[model samples]
Target: MPRGYGGTKGVRRPGVALALHFAFADLWHDRKLSVLGVILLAALLAPPVVLHTLQVGLVETWARDLAADLRNREVVIVGEHQVDADLLAALRAWPETGFAVPEPSFFVTTQTARLVGGRGSSVPLDMRTTSPGDPVLARADLPPPGQAGLILSARAAAELKADPGSEISILLQRTPTGGAVERREVILPVAGILPEAHWPGRTGFVSEGALLGFGDYLTFSSDTPDYRAPEDDERWQSLRIYAPEVSQAPALRDRLQNAGFETRLMTDQVDRILRLETGLRQLFGLVLSLSALAFVATTILIQWLSVLRKRRDFALMAVLGMSRRETATFPLVQGATMTAIAAALALGLAAAMGGSVEAMAQGYLAQPTEIVRPNLIPLLAGALGAVALGGLAGAVAVVRLGRLDVSRALRGD
Candidate 1:
């Protein structure tokens, strides 16, 4: 053995070793109680979990809405037939605007997209085309507008089992160029798939130059007055624009209004999403309040009772020359130690359960989703907090015991 390692000169001091043995001996007899205390302490570590789950669903919904809003850009609305030649020219020259085609005011639709899944088919309708440089929002596939190709929305592509170079058909309502109600089936090669939009379950988009040709429900008539299907002209719908930052949306809207466009900022698409975030915060607070109250009440009550029940054993130790300081500090040590162990167990449980909880929250969301990564701050704080609250309560409850008559304790009366 090395010179100091053998213990003649320096190992742990003998007195320190003896104290360690005695402390362990005392703790050994009470090991079951310690285990029980730890379990109780850990049970209180559940508040943060409930709150974080609510946050996950909310943030998921918020992101999808934000992405959709960004894609929609800004819309420009014209007064009824107010898009005169001069107004059209002025609007057309604006750098941010694209597809300056005339269309109606309110733009929305519900349509079914048919897919040719897993088979090879042939026909003129089977070979569709769109212009190459289509000004697409969040173009997952790069397709140039004006080229003969079709850009499908992510939902559309999925519905059609489509990919680049696949030819597909659009079912539009008919207009009689000659005599009959001709169902126009324009086949375009699938040039690209747009990103998944936050708008759920449906898909719509177009090549830059193309108007929404027509719909299946209405046929164009001449003398009967229902000639062009409603959305064929672009001027009807408000002009949509996008800014680099969300903070710029209001500013851009104001500027456009000032420029004499009858504009109402429709960020309801975005605001409705953010409203979900607010709801989540409120829900989290509700969960937190209930959880915190339970932990505080249960922990303080149990720890304080345990400390009092063990007072006589402690009082005898004091009579045997253990100091008043030792008597006062014992409950603190026991409470903190028990709480610390519970904290460790709770951390393990939280981590194991976090992913599952987050997934559940994501499923509940109405928007884009991201995986949850529970941070360490809550875990660490929870444990230490329990320790503090429990120790304080335990020590306070034992304060009267520390002042007890040694004779009464000794006389067993």
Candidate 2:
């Protein structure tokens, strides 16, 4: 008998502490069984951890890559329409709207431009209106509003042999109603160069104010001495609308369509990505649920069997004056300790498996990005759940311990 089991009041140990000591000793005495239980539990836990880590990492990485594509979140007006400031304001007020800029007619927006100091034929560049928060220019330096500055796309810059700080001459030609053709050349400094991934075609991005001014110049006679830009109430021919997130693009597109606006969006791609993510989550949830159930069942069965085998030992402890509460706590403490160790082992195994998968993806699959990274929150949560479930399982065994016939068990009946 342990010294603390039936000790005098002066030397008596705490009930829980004494039970913990006996639990550890009992586990050590049956070290092989304890080790086997830990191995079995770890084996059950590791696969789900690895699967969840990979699934979350891969899906998150894919979603991030898709979301980074500005085109996926853009809703382009199909053709020329009389878009107005009020409409633009209304669209901007929508929670789903990330950015909305009115555009001039496509006929007036395309202009022949050439570098002022370079020797290259003039190239017809499609000018797009941009504002401060334009997603297309997210990585490019935006020109100041109302300034004669241009941000040229990679193709436009290449064709003009121009870079940032270079000056480009935009030749604006328009035939006024029942009048001869009018031509005007405007030289603007290149503020920045957009990456090819942002705008691939031969395009130039100018401030909305600048585009409006150019449209006004082309629409009216250039000979007017007091050339004033169009008023804010002036209607536009098109609009460039963007959603803050790709998931919102479909809804925004539907809203525009419902309002009699024809727009184009990558809704099919967005829907596919969304569906994939949802399906993966559901599948992973089912797998995790089954795994957890199996773990609980195994823990309860194994711990109950262990308690049944040690019935006489608990009976002997009761005979030695140990309280029933203390005796019942033995299996609970042992189960918690074993499960804690198993959780650690499972985490280690998951890390190893995840590393192997990541290595394979990097080396042979040609995926350089991390695709099996484990999130700390989920890992900690899983570990805590395992320990809690293990305690619950042990509690079930403790219920059986309460039913033990002390005298009969001690008599080896």
Q: 19-51, model 2: which lDDT tens digit per residue?
A: 788899999999999999999988888778877
Q: What is the lDDT of residue 270 in candidate 2?
A: 67
Listed per candidate, the RMSD to the true structure in angstroms reads: 9.1, 5.0
Cα RMSD for predicted model 1: 9.1
TM-scores for all candidates: the values are 0.56, 0.77
Candidate 1 residues 118-174, lDDT tens each?
A: 453322221111233324433344645343355666666666777866767654444
Score residue 213 of candidate 2 by CA lDDT: 72
Clashing pairs in 2: none
| Residue 275 displacement in candidate 2 (angstroms) | 4.2
Give residue 30's lDDT in candidate 2 (0 to 100).
97
